[model samples]
Target chain A: MSSTLTVADVERIAALAQLELTAEEKQLFTKQLADILDYAEQLQAVDTSGVPATAHVLGEPVERDDAERPSLAIDEAVGNAPDPASAPGLFRVPRVIG
Target chain B: MLQSTASAIREDVASGRVSAVEVCRAFLDRTTAVNAALNAFNLVTSERALAQAAEIDRRRAAGQTLGVLAGVPVAIKDNLCVRGMTTTASSRILEHFVPPYDATVVARLAAADAVVIGKTNCDEFAMGSSNENSAFGPVRNPWAQDRTPGGSSGGSAAAVAARCAPLALGSDTGGSIRQPAGFCGVVGLKPTYGRVSRYGLLAFASSLDQIGPFTHTVRDAALALSAIAGADPSDATASREAVPDFAASLTGDIKGLRIGVPRAFVADGVDAGVRAAFDAAIGTLRGSGAQLVDIELPHARYAIPVYYLVATAEASSNLARYDGVRYGYRSARDKDQNLKQMYSRTRDEGFGAEVKRRIMLGTYVLSAGYYDAYYLKAQQVRTLVRQDYQQAFEKVDVIAMPTSPIPPFRLGERTGDPLQMYLADVFTVSANLAGLPAISVPCGFSEGHLPVGLQLTGRMFDEATLLRAADAYERETDWHAQAPAI
Candidate 1:
């Protein structure tokens, strides 16, 4: 099977990623992403019957004691915020709603 | 003084034969001298290095016992945070973002008393195979100014090769560390996944990323690994396995060690020089009393496809945190713009071409209708890749292959064709997929004099065996001793 990535699909994916691509990028990605996915279609040939998908290489879930420890201070947590000083302890962003 | 090994520097500083301050100065001077020609360092932390060095001297004067790495100078890949240092992953997004805390590995290096020389440049967000994707600029290979130092850990590898620092930290997600190390003719080790803590490493494909080191020698790689390999409460993924003294494991003996060589996998698409060097490396292993067995890793050839899918999927998710409101670059806004538009504009403006490409590819594969066809299929194939290694390890202690399919290519060589660049990692990505420890040691050079590496991959959490085999190979070859004439 070949990838048929179209401009509309590229726009949808870009929107999902919260990326504003230039018109040139959208056109370029349509062609490039298709080539990549086409190459990735090689996986379809492998009969992975009864195979389990691995999210991580390590098999077991790591568990630690439910314990309290010193965490990042409020100031340090927001230290790298784009607008750190304006809002005492919180990050300031553009208005979310009308 | 600049070419002194990490172990030698540690000993001299501890004995007061050479002050830590003096060693730091020598490396700082070397970095200043050669960095312009190589573009290896993104920022040199001179003040911090001197301060740390002086503190080491002060402690020694007071008759305090020095730490394992006492006065060794090391470079950090920009992806790993150094407290208060501008830790951009070589991307515009984080161009001015200074991390508030040091990464767990960085803190461990300090705990071992190693001096941090500076941060080195890398592929943006450690996303590309070549360092060309760095927003700052591409790092030139010391061997040939026009060729790429294999990356995304190019600067760290170049710095070690140029003798600016005895060691440098690099993270391997696909072939980041090993590929660069091979091209630079230095030793690069990627310890078992979860072997080294990744607490403050700017997340890039979390499941695959592993922190390791580039050093002038295999023993130094082993030494560096010992100082930073362990579990951390902050990183639940870090293994709880006992951190063995990796240096002690380098007995310079691989007698009767069984090495698996997948001749069929490496047969085609290999450069002639690399193939000859690999053959000689196998001969050397045999001459050293190590047993060689032919093995199969049928799924390894598919590593590039599987890696691109899984790695990009994870990258799309991890990088989603880089919205305009948080730490990092945010695009200037018009008054009426909303939050979503701000994030979009910020990422588009801040990210480089390759990073955007990966993010886009990642987002597509994980999209609703395509998830099972692409991402899930890739993961299942990933299990096949791991099982191949597991089956092979049952018969052999380690698997051997060329670190990269070909030697370092010219700058701008493969950048245009992303698929061709992905294929260069043909032999190296299996280690990451299988969570096995792997190392790249300089075996020989190409006809063009660019270096070629021989990679040895071992079972999970068995860095000792891998380090032992690499150290044993180093004992039999002088390729590691050769330095590029800058």
Candidate 2:
């Protein structure tokens, strides 16, 4: 009994994602998007009782030693940059804010 | 020679019958030939492969002891960072990004002397059941050109299926590895969460994502698992237990083993052909002296919802690093704008459509007003889903089901129906929910010549039993030997 996703929903999602979609893509994604949502919504009916909610299945937190190990050289890390200009240490991005 | 398993390759390398360079070149040549059509690889590390292969040859000449997997060629899913290699996760955002360090799995594989062939394609950020979500493009199923290779490990599965690589590494969260393996008719395993470290893997759903192996045969998959799975200082969550030699369990005997069939979960919406093949596989196991039991996992019905909510919420948080401030695509025209525009334009131009959709949906579910209604409820339901499996495990040694509801569908068949694509993961997602180890092995073929996978889900940390059952089944069946007619 799930309904299809509307074009408006797709547009809203695109806006949230900051993606600019073409008209054709929007049309195609409407049906596709609806189907995905409907399928995901199928989990709405299960009953969970007396069970502890798990955040990490392995039941352990990700931890690494705080010790500093030899790391990649800064030059080597950014050496492959497509374009390097004023920024000598990192990959440079165009200035967006005035 | 191309059809030889990783074990054989190791033996050949040790014996000097084949040098690592020869093996690497053969695989590279084959990959190059099929890659154009299959799109299985995102990057080809021919130079790297040759260099590693030569190093192995030098070690052999110097009479140095070789690692168990010496000179074996393996492909890594792009999501797992390999230092100096572009680990794009099949997203345009990181299209040119190279990792500064190798993931734990990659380092392990290299330690075993396995030559890293290249990076394979995946669904963007390991989201979506179909590889179509990859900004690079969908990987074509090697079985049928027009059909999709299941994802987000679609390329890893396809690479093995097409014989491009004998073994490949993939990450499974909500069936990414198993589902794609099912579609491509290869062997894929998702070990118990924490069995493998997640140190270098680009986080999808951290709780669910586990790096696993895809191979032509179950034992090879087991070998890869043994090599890569263990405690790591880099991943605090990694299990502290000593890594077991999974290859030692591949005796191909499951006598007196109990295998459960969840009639309630697997029977619904299963394609007739898939069901027939799965049943026949059960019959084969029964004939091999294993006991088959009917078990019910009532909470499985909620897995999809719980998985989506949790996975998306985590994805929303993990992917927030791509704000055009760090590594990833940035907007060229948005320079000198406000911080908000920088983030908005950068993400807009960087991420693929599917990724954006998930982020929005995830953010909505985790929003202040909707958290309890969506995210919190999903977590509660996840507990129920986990309990269902726990209860089922109390009654059986392992659970058996169809790896996928159906065989590979036509490439574009469900491209327009995201719901249908998501449903394709229904059979494989439960194990991820329970943090269980599971594997997909080729069982039989449909009339159309496409392969069907028989899935075996084991109890938490009971990968030995799962591999035993799968190896036993594989010994009795020829499904794993049947490759695509490429």
Candidate 3:
């Protein structure tokens, strides 16, 4: 019931997650990743029959009114940005899709 | 006066015996002294706590009324957001992230005038049974430095157990709060799902994640629950039912209560010390006039599997929001790549190893062709697990079991073996799946001097009954009073 997660698998996952893992991180993660997956596999053996799958336990569909409300000032939201001048109203990041 | 419970703190402020500022300073000082060893808190908001305390004092001086938990210092799990405070979820991904708003529980606690002392550490993204997954570092067991404080709410439990704060809030997806509480020898309750609002608490398993409290005593736990429990406008899934006064039912009276013992699930594979302590706890309850009956939950064996499928699937979806475009960490590389590459690179850089592992497994399970066999089948089994609890509750008022199978193991003992670590949560996972209210209260200490908790689970939304039983048990034994030697 145990499986080893390889470095390639880790790299693929990092790609999927939009992360840039260093080579050392990938190596360290290979062992740690395998251990976690092995642990999660323990759930495979439990018998669940007739038990209703609950997406949410509260069961009650809590909906809020879709009314518009005053929003946070744009400056306030971006005020804490490490570099506010890079982008006028949004967080500036490195160029993408070149 | 500073040692009083949240209820007493409110009363004292009202009666003018102590000022809110005085209470805040006392807890702040204690938190400072022990935080170095426990690593329980990621940040201590002394200035903010003092400011809030001063406001409470102003209201008291002006003869204005205060909420039930007025001026009580409470620590919140880092996963739960607080306005203008860092909500890291103990992961490197959100290491510099500061939430702009408060979680539903945080907002409610603030409304009640509860002074938030700081944010406590947890397993990264509430993923692990032990706190070792935290990127910041493992939170040491307050009771024993070498052993772990159970997680993902280890910091919260340790904070409460070490007397740093009388009360703390923690999230339990799969026994995060309860397991850590057990390891640290404190009272931790996981309310029925939706009993507390989940508006701003970081989602782990959207279905199972619940925020509850850790406290020194059962009564304290009840008071904290009352303050945080109730429906909220922000969380659409919040229960519409009125929250009862949990502290009002603290008079230990379970005269004809049918306490069910799940012979198949709880009794098997339990450590000898845990079993002895559990049996002794049952004997004490029996002596107290509570009837203990054997109940079989045939689907109990499948709880772990169903929990993982459902939890991981939902976690995969929920964690998808952590793209670098919106918030948190973004990869410095992959700039020239398309949106897909940007997303992949950001998430890979942001999330810790455990989080990435789960996302991958979830994606694989829910992928095309495998969905029906793995994800769909697991969902069907989840229904069965829920049914078992429903049927069991029809016959019993509450169920009793050992909170964890063994005492807190060494920090790195199970790190190398993931399955062994997941097995640690076996006894505590079913309650979350069933959306039942459960608590882990210190029952006894192991030979190695670690705390053992007796887990009491009750029917959905039946937290009062669980509290009553735990209060009665605490009355007879002084186990909850035993602190870690450190």
TM-score of chain A of each: 0.90, 0.72, 0.77
Candidate 2: docking tier: acceptable
lDDT by residue (tens digit), candidate 1, B272-355: 999999999999999999999999999988899999999999999999999968699988866668888899999999999899
Cα shift from native, residue B268, model 1 (Å): 0.6
**Model 2 chain B weakest lDDT span, ten residues long:** B333-342
TM-score of chain B of each: 0.99, 0.99, 0.97
Please report the candidate that would top lDDT against the real structure: 1
What is the model-wide C-alpha lDDT for candidate 1?
Answer: 0.93
Q: lDDT, candidate 1, residue B126?
A: 95
Measured against the true two-chain complex, the DockQ scores of the candidates, in the order shown, are 0.85, 0.41, 0.42
List candidate 3 stretches off by more than 4 Å.
Answer: A1-15, A19-53, A79-87, B1-3, B334-339
DockQ of 3: 0.42
RMSD of 3: 2.7
- Can you write out model 2's per-residue Cα lDDT over B388-466, one digit (the tens) per residue? 7888888889899999888888877876555567767888887887889999999888768778899999988889889
